[model samples]
Target chain A: MNDIVLNVSNIGKHFGGLQALENVNLQIEAGKTHAIIGPNGAGKSTLLNVCVGRIKPDTGSVKFLGDNLTGRKPHEINQLGVARVFQTPEIFPELTLLRNVMVPAFAKREGAFKLNAFRKVDNEAEVRDEAEHILEDVGLKEQMNGLAGSLSRGDKRRLELAMCLIQHPKLLLLDEPTAGMSRHDTNRTIDLLRLIKERGMTKVIIEHDMHVVFSLADHISVLAQGQIIVEGSPDMVRGNARVQEAYLGGAHV
Target chain B: MAQLWHRNDLLLMGVFTLAVLAMPLWLAPFGAGYPDLLQKLAIYGIFAIGFNILFGLTGYLSFGHAAFLGVGSYAAVWSFKLFTMNVLPAVLFGTLLAGVFAALIGFISLRRSGIYFSILTLAFAQMSYNLAYSVLTPITNGETGLQLTQSDPRIIDRLYVEATSGLPSTELFGLKMSGYPGFYFCAAILIIAFFFSVRIFNSPFGVKLLAIKSNQTRMGYTGYNTRPYLLVAFVISGMYAGLAGSLLAVTDPLAGAERMQWTASGEVVLMTILGGAGTLIGPLLGAGLIKYFENVFSAYNEAVLHQIFAMLPDWLQSAMVFVVNPFVGEGWHLTLGALFVLIVIFLPGGIMEGIRRLSSLVRRIIARSRRDGLQAA
Candidate 1:
């Protein structure tokens, strides 16, 4: 569909004798937060990895905005407006928070890679202003000069979110963003995700936290044993008998 | 104000330049012998600085930087022999050729990072050495080495004298030195190279290089194609090595395949690490220390040792000679190896780190003294 930002069809990934992921199908629209919830070792990360072109599926197709993303390199996939945040906050640790955000801004502004050596970065006033705005959005304006490595965990995740969002990607894939956050920080993250969605960006969050999934997910897909057990609206998935049996520890629905 | 100065990479560079220029004067008590050592130190300093940019900042340890340096020297020598005898063309050609060589190597080496990158560069450098030694005999002049002929047909030399009278004993702009002008010329070029390095280090590109080193995978996911950034950095560093190579030929005007050898590449790595891998001034300090051992340590002979040892009893002197023997005598490599091990074990940050720590201590003392003075006032 024209509004579909990402479409994964019958994707499967296998590593020798072990199956990492099995027949999975997912569809994300242009401006929605789609959460994939699964228990430990449920292939939520592998699915996200496949979406971001970090790993190739043994069989299947990943389509983003009508283009096949299956064989493309991660950077190439990113250039096509798919930004991913790692399970761990992956940022240039030694660089300042401002510079970390600037990396994506540079890529987006100067298509692919550029050798813009002689031009001063400050001379590009627009990009710098936009980067500052991004930092402001992520609540890191005060710590712009602070090294990325020195930031607290929540701030690092926020900084990374800013980095991905600054690129203005059509789709953002987040892997366990609130995995290690405290309840306060997790709620703060849910609020951030709400703000991003409210601003009209599509996101796919692979989260183990059921509260986060139930609260933030517009559409929830429950994964089990490397395959999609069920996908429906958050309340429907939360109420599904099979989802309860497979993922919700067979709890009463 | 002091904090601002320290934060400003350019200001630090200017201070470094002033210190480097004034180095010979500070060691003037050691006289002409020391200036030559200082010159060698500065030359290798530039070499190590370039190598450090590629390896230290980018974390792409290259075991083949000598190939670029050696080729750069060859380019400079060729420029001197065929075109202008002036150092400018030679240095330019040398550095540009190094960049070109780096582009080719980087294209392939960038395909694989980590250990594979190191092995690829090493293999390529070895290939360059072999080509220089044998197949490229016409250009590199084979085993005998590429040097300037007394009957060189260069236009810059022709402009100074009648074309009929020929090369005019290789005087630089009519100020004849027993090659002292050549040495000074090299020093000036090194100064320029150092300045260039400072500009680059402070640039956005330099920051990106550091980022690439930190997490290339993250960079890639962040919509950055890190390969191009890495390639550009590789080329820039290669050009710096080229400039150093050109300066080497300007001082002595001889380029040999030995300069491209794996051991030579290994030396630059040692220099950079010994000085301080990531810090700006570390490579220069490391290069200076290693080159000092190569030149000054090798200069000490049995007669000089005897002259110093004569004050002691004959038996005791013999024992002293034996004790001081390996480091002072023919075992200069042993001294270098020992120095390397000592630096690695104790001062891994190299001489630059040692200096930084010393300066910090001084600063702390100054701050305490100021506090005391303020209370008294």
Candidate 2:
């Protein structure tokens, strides 16, 4: 129980008549990369959304570090040290890269609400330095002043990762972090994830890319049709027959 | 970056202050040096600045801001009637009352966003307008509106001096709030409002508001409570509108229900958008331009047109008036409408975009000339 950073038990959700998720259970271990992979319309995203408090589940609850997060607000959950990187890189497109990173840092430092209307954001030297350092770590230091909206797809994803990293989250959730990246960028991201893994931060990555999953995940959960088909070490999941059948039945993810 | 940004902001503020203080001199050539027009420019400038905080930054459009203005006006007049002839208390009370009212309205309106929020604000303002016009006639003074009357208990003013010759006007200490002194007073408040807006634009709170505008979903997951930031912005802007309305009452003590009318609310929206929503100085420019058009341009008649086209032949002059008549005088809205359409289509950033384009064009020209000179050498 101490080793489990996030616990999802019997999370069931439906949209109208369509059963998106039913009797779902997941537990992410501390200091390990857990990958949730499934085919399209498998309710993979819905399950992720439920965990993040974006969608309220029909049944059961989500617990983070033994605290109930089932019906809590998204920001409330985030302030509890959970950060999400969206598939399409939901970022402040108009803000500069540095400002984008600093925003999340402020959120972490100031909590859910701070009446900091008089103090200059630039004057927050501690947060600014961390943001700059993180941008440098992500190899975006040269273009830190450029608007995030003008970034390439891969760069935007990288910026989003930097934004999350600045929060120093206990549980980092990445939704297809390399969704629109080129092969070269994907490989680069894999190396970056490997570096993050070395830091011992627990991460839950939702990915369709097997290369990414195999390269980064220590633990793998094979979700098919809103249910986990196989859950074990990466090697065991790779050899599981149910997982193979689940993938082969559809255009393989 | 902080030092450089601060210096740039300071320079802008300095220039703005100089421009505002010297308005009478600079505007004299254009026949807008008059006190009444100058006061309007300053008051409306403050209104636009506040409106931009909500609409431009957070992308929340409240179509009932003029209701706050009306609230401010009524509060200021009541202060004058009960407390003293001093403008200080009236201004403070007006702003405070407007802020409290905004807190109530924003709490409800902010529950919805986008067009729903705009509609909710509009409905609230209209309700306030009708109530003040009819239902709350005793307090609001109904169709006659709230005005200074000799028979009323002046309270503080009465204690100082017994008996009044006629109706007493508003004042600041001993300084009369009319003509040039009134313009200066409004200008000072406008400057203070502009400075606070500058601080807000630079603050973390401001960034969060922008984040809310850019991607609210991301802000939620980033752990920023968006509603409180939005409500604060709403109250601040509401206070700004209230201040503008109070200044109106200060210069000419009258608080009519028309101040809360939807058209007044719509006018502020036009000012903010017409200038540039997000930019610091843009809304002020928009307010000045709209106010100029409304006051100066609308004052033009066929007589003024004849004066302008006097160098031409009689027939040509008459023909010119016929062509130009619709765009000036009573048809100033036609001119304003055409200008607004052109601005929305061509320069969506309002006048600021045009300034930026011009400055960049000049910079390119200078850079090319310098490069050519270097090559020649």
Candidate 3:
């Protein structure tokens, strides 16, 4: 069995009376893609946010490589080789695509803070080349000089993925990587994930698209109303009765 | 081989040196060659440039920067009273003190951003102004301001050498800080400050600042501790204002409570926005233009306006003066307000953006003409 890269135990979060996440326990193994599939308002985003330190859970602990990640700032968690791709592609809009990628590259390379005022950013040839390489890998090399804000929605999503990928995180957390894309774009994204999977990077993807879930997930967890109904392989998840009643049944009805 | 002067640092230094060295010759045409106006230009230019680092780059608009300037002035004046009349110690003390003060204010104020941040700074500045005017009268001398007196012990000058003058003037190794020499001294320091600003603009630190401006939430998630970065910027800018304040005292030798007023802070903000906040040369141009109008244009009364149009018929000249009356002399502020409105309406990017648009338009016209000529041939 592969070593577990991320482990979450007794994670529970509440907003007033609504339970966002309740008694959530998850263990993601290294070099595997785990997909969390749930209906609308099913606490997928809340779980992801908790894992990435965006929100503090009411009770629980998140451990990555034996280090506790509870109550840490988002940036502090990011420094520990856990990169997150936002649902809407949170990127530096005014900056060029090359610079958008380079910001994370600088953060990953230089740690949290460095007073490099006198030194020119362009002088860091290695960082620039690495940024360029990532852009090329993501097929955004031609538009590297273009402003990130001006890119189409599909390209913006791709650029954001490239930014997270450049950090070479031990574990990547993608929150609805293809949230608002056409079928063509979704297919492209699925292909991209398959390509990323070959590199042996562990990823936890929170997606609602069943096609994407079945295509990429080595292990699928079907969540509904703040709790996972079933955890199994894609074939097993497709055949589970509780998951059908809670998720697939509701979708059809 | 690449030319040594082609490097950005060297080029910037060369241009700044040329501008400062030629200030006397060029400024003479505007009747502003006198040391007083020239010194004010350099001092305010430093103030605006420092303000730009925080407001322009980081989008953290500070409304209390003048408080630092006032603090700096007080520190310099105290330095003069306790130490020698040399400007070095005064400048150092002013800058360091302002930095400390800025760190304290910035630590608390940066907790909130946008208008809340601005209000916090404004409140702190008002409190300081009030304290300086009333409760801190012993240190600040109240409304009278702090000035050097003969009775004050100049321990350094007295211990080292004999006193020759009735009242000592601010100096650098016996070079008096007055007239053309004083202007040159301030101009030299302004050049150094400008160079540092340019370096910061091109650095990785600058990119991070722009990122903070873009999205603070995303910046935090990207593994950047933005608070320290912001605080450092705030302190650096405050030090710049302090440096400017020290220069003001170095030349004139007075530290007044009124200097810390909100209007003084507003003036720097005006200078930055009027010129182009983020651009390198914008703040300097804004400072120079505002000072020029305040000093020169305000001096043009109705008599001077009438004299300029003396060749025209009596009725025509009176008509011209009547039309121009509200824009000059005591009404110069009206002209400034009108210009600001026009710029905001048409060129929201300020004077620098206007220049960019004009140049691009010119380029387009030239390119089209060239294309037509080629087609005709």
Candidate 4:
């Protein structure tokens, strides 16, 4: 078996009286694309949040690469090589696309904080070159100097991906990376994911698109009512009656 | 090639710096009145520029930044009283103390951003002011304020130098460097501060600060601890404020609790917003504008107006007076208030943004004319 990178056991999270995620247990190995699929309130986002240390689970233990990730700050987890992409494509709007990619790269270089007051940013050709390379890899070399806000939604998502990729994260958690994209853009995103997978990145993706789930996920977990209803390979989960009834609405082949 | 250095911005700043540096020499013919006003303008400009970094870039509108300035002033004063009066140590102590104070306030206040953060900083500043006023009377000297007394022994006071009749000799190496020298010293420090701010503005840290301002939650999820970044920014800005405060005290060795008031804190924000929050030169312009109005306009009394009125016809003069009364006469604050409102409504980005728009418009017109000529050919 591959080394277990993440181990979540008996996780429960509640908002006042309403349970968001309950009795959730999952294990993900290195270099695996783990997909979490669920209905509206199936706790996919909540689970990702708990894993990244964005929100503390009421009752759970999250161990990431042998380190306790539960209740740690998001940046701390990120420092340990975990990065996230927001659903809405959160990016620095005023900065150029290249500058956006350079931020995390700079942070990683400077070690969380740096005071290079006298040194001009342009003088750091190494950092700039790395950012440009990542931008090229994300197919944004032409629009390197374009303001991030002016980019199309799909391009913005790509820019966000490039920003995270620059950090060289051990685990990349993506929240709806293809949300609101047309078929063309969606396919491009899937292609980008394939590229990422080819590079041997361990990824956990929360996706509503069954196409995205079936296409890339090594292991699929169907969540319903804050609990996992089924967990298996795509073929096994596709045949599960409970997953079809509760998640796929009996439409799965 | 796409140029990294913003050519137009650099040219404008260069021109502006030259103009400011030459003003004292120009005003030398007029018997030394202009340099004093110019120096005050530069000093406050430093204060406003620091305030702009926190409020403008980070979107953390601090209503209590004056407290850091006050802390700096007190630290500078104490340094002069106890240690060597070499000015360098005083400035360093002031900046360091301000950083320490900012770290404490930033840790607590940064936990809650927006209006709550503003209120928390304001509360801490108010507490500081009250403490300086009464609780720390021995150190702060209460209402009388900090001053160099005759009883105080000076280790490096340079008492051998001949002092001017009214002015105490703030000397360095047996040379009288108080009035003009003090102004020059402050100017040099302001230049350094400007350079530091510009570097930070262009760096990745600045980009991160803007990202935090835009969407902190997004930054958090993207592997940034927004709190630490914000706290660091706050401390840096506070240190800048402290440097400004230390400079003020160095120019005239006095520190008062009133310098730490909430109203004074608000003044720096006003200067930044009125000048141009995000722009480098905007804060300087805002400070210059406010200080100019305060010093020059306030000095224009009825006697100064009467001299001008004597040259015009009685009826015409009365009309002119009436027209200027709301803005320049007794209603000076009304003028300030109106100016503030107009800037907020019309020029929301401040004077620097206005200049940018005007220049861009001019460029477009020039480009169009050139294209038209080419098309005619």
lDDT of model 2 at residue B312? 100
List model 2 lDDT by residue over B1-377, tens digit each: 77897898889999999999999999889889999999999999999999999999899999999999999999999999998989999999999999999999999999999999999999999999999999999999999999988877878888888857788888998889999999999999999999999999989999989989999989999998899989999999999999988888999999999999999999898888888899999999999999988998899999999999999999999999999999998899998889899999999999998999999999999999999999999
lDDT of 4 by residue, B142-208 (tens): 9999876654555555354332344353444445447777777777777778867887887667777
Please give the clash total of every predicted structure, in order.
Answer: 1, 0, 0, 0
Give the C-alpha interface root-mean-square deviation per candidate: 3.1, 0.9, 2.0, 2.5
Candidate 4 CAPRI-style tier? acceptable
Which RMSD does model 4 reach against the true structure? 3.0
Q: Which pairs clash inside model 2?
A: none
Local distance difference test, per candidate? Answer: 0.82, 0.92, 0.90, 0.83
- DockQ of every model listed? 0.51, 0.86, 0.63, 0.48
- RMSD in Å for candidate 1, one decimal? 3.2
Q: Which DockQ value does candidate 2 get?
A: 0.86
Worst 10 residues of 3 chain A by lDDT: A244-253
Error of 2 at A79 (Å): 0.6
Interface RMSD of 4: 2.5
Model 3 vs truth, CA RMSD:
2.1
Q: Highest DockQ: give the candidate number.
A: 2
Q: Rank the candidates by DockQ, best first.
A: 2, 3, 1, 4
Candidate 2 C-alpha lDDT tens digits along A1-253: 2499999999999999998888889899899999998888888889889988999999989999989999999999999989999878999999999999999999998899998899998789898899999998888999999999999989999999999999989999999999999999899889988988889889999999898999999899888888888889988988778888887355343
Best candidate according to lDDT: 2
Q: Least accurate stretch of 10 residues (summed lDDT) in model 2 chain A?
A: A244-253
Task: Give the docking tier of candidate 1.
Answer: medium
Please give the RMSD to the true structure for each candidate, in Å.
3.2, 1.4, 2.1, 3.0
